[model samples]
Target: MEGPAGEKVPSDNQVKTFERTATGLVREISAFRTLVLDLMFTSPVFMFVFAILGIGIFVGADMVVSTLLALLIGFTTAGMYALLSIAYPRSGGDYIFISRILSPPLGFMVNFVFTIVNISVIGTEAVWVSTMALGPMFSGLGAIMNSSSLASYASVFSQPVYIFIIGAVVMLVFTSVMFFGTGPTFKIKSVLFFVAVFSVIVYIAAIGLTSTSAMISNFNHLSSTSYQQYSGIVTSNGLPEKFEVVPTL
Candidate 1:
């Protein structure tokens, strides 16, 4: 029946608000699952583990201390994730929790900090990936230009231009996916997950097949004077080998 304002109005008994709400919640959950799957594929776990291994190998005996530090960091990170997840299971992340538990001012500060950290990470990743790409490119260019005395020119190619370009492209693609909404993002996530899993399996297989004798030889070299000499050479090439500070006296 039409109301006085000529608008059709529902009878109290005609509306199923709770059913509609439940349906919407289910859809949201499905979408969230896709988002999480994508994130899992793109996660930094492999890089993190490789970084820890590198530090362990390079720092040698100091790995004991590094391992302890990594453990402490991991524990704290896990605790924070647990606390945030539990506090806002429905809302599902730190932003809402921050706003609710604290004043809006504090919440903004938290978000600001997070933005800075995220951008810093993006910048660092772009540089690192570009550097990795440059290694082979530089080597190839160096060989080609060997007779031309263009090793310096080859060195110029080592700059992270490719890295920044690739990073920008990735950022743009992801941003577009976000704008178009979660459907495509979810698909991308599934592919990423498969790739990540396959890569991990292959890495483990390779490591397992490596010769024990070769591993021992590598370990011995790491412990020898040559390793220290190489470390010093690498460090000094990048930065001053020693710092001189004038005495206050």
Candidate 2:
């Protein structure tokens, strides 16, 4: 298309360049799906659930008040996520949101804080994973070597040194992976994502079935004893005045 004043208009080449850029963006977005799934699988949800269960067990409440507290906190966190998404609706996340809400200086400061927190979280995760990986090896070392003299000296020297070495190794590996860029990182993460999901499903199924079976056996024994005591066949300690039936799903 040309203007009537003999001036050259935007040509097909310019249009083609814009289209190519758009196509590249679409391809990148499509490729990111696996990375997103990987993140979802390795998320904090599992740790959060385990923490809540541990708290409930340790608190020893008949009705588990910690469960309610967890629910409330979860709801509030979800609401915050929703609010942030609605407000920003962009890729850069809180940095963009803060910039929109306040001055650039404030936004940069908030972004710096977010970066620090994110790095700290990454460091913590690396430490936790290293602990899980090396705990068995350290325990084995302790068992083979008596703790009286040699083992004690070994433990004292090895603990901090091993931890430091592990931390350094983890950091180096992660840094190398990151430096390689998103493509290779995403590929490895995709495999880890599937592994994490499969592990969780297997763990949950095993624990759930075992717990249910144990509960059913205990319930049957309790019911039989209650029946015997009610019929005046034998004396039972702490018999309920009235039997209450609880439904299990």
lDDT, candidates in the order shown: 0.59, 0.57
In the predicted model 2, the residue pairs found to clash are none
Best by TM-score: 1
Report the Cα lDDT for residue 46, model 2.
Answer: 56
> Lowest-lDDT window of 10 residues in candidate 2?
240-249
Question: In model 1, where is the ten-residue run with the lowest total lDDT?
Answer: 240-249
Could you tell me the lDDT of residue 88 within candidate 1?
Answer: 59
lDDT of 2 by residue, 17-47 (tens): 1112224344254436645653664474455
Residue pairs with clashing backbones, model 1: 38-189
Please provide TM-scores, in order, for all candidate models, with all chains considered together: 0.56, 0.55
lDDT value, residue 146 of candidate 1: 53
Off by over 4 Å in 2: 1-27, 31-42, 45-58, 61-72, 79-91, 136-158, 212-249
Which lDDT tens digits does candidate 1 get at residues 173-215? 7668767666667767767677766877786686788887775
lDDT of 1 at 224: 40
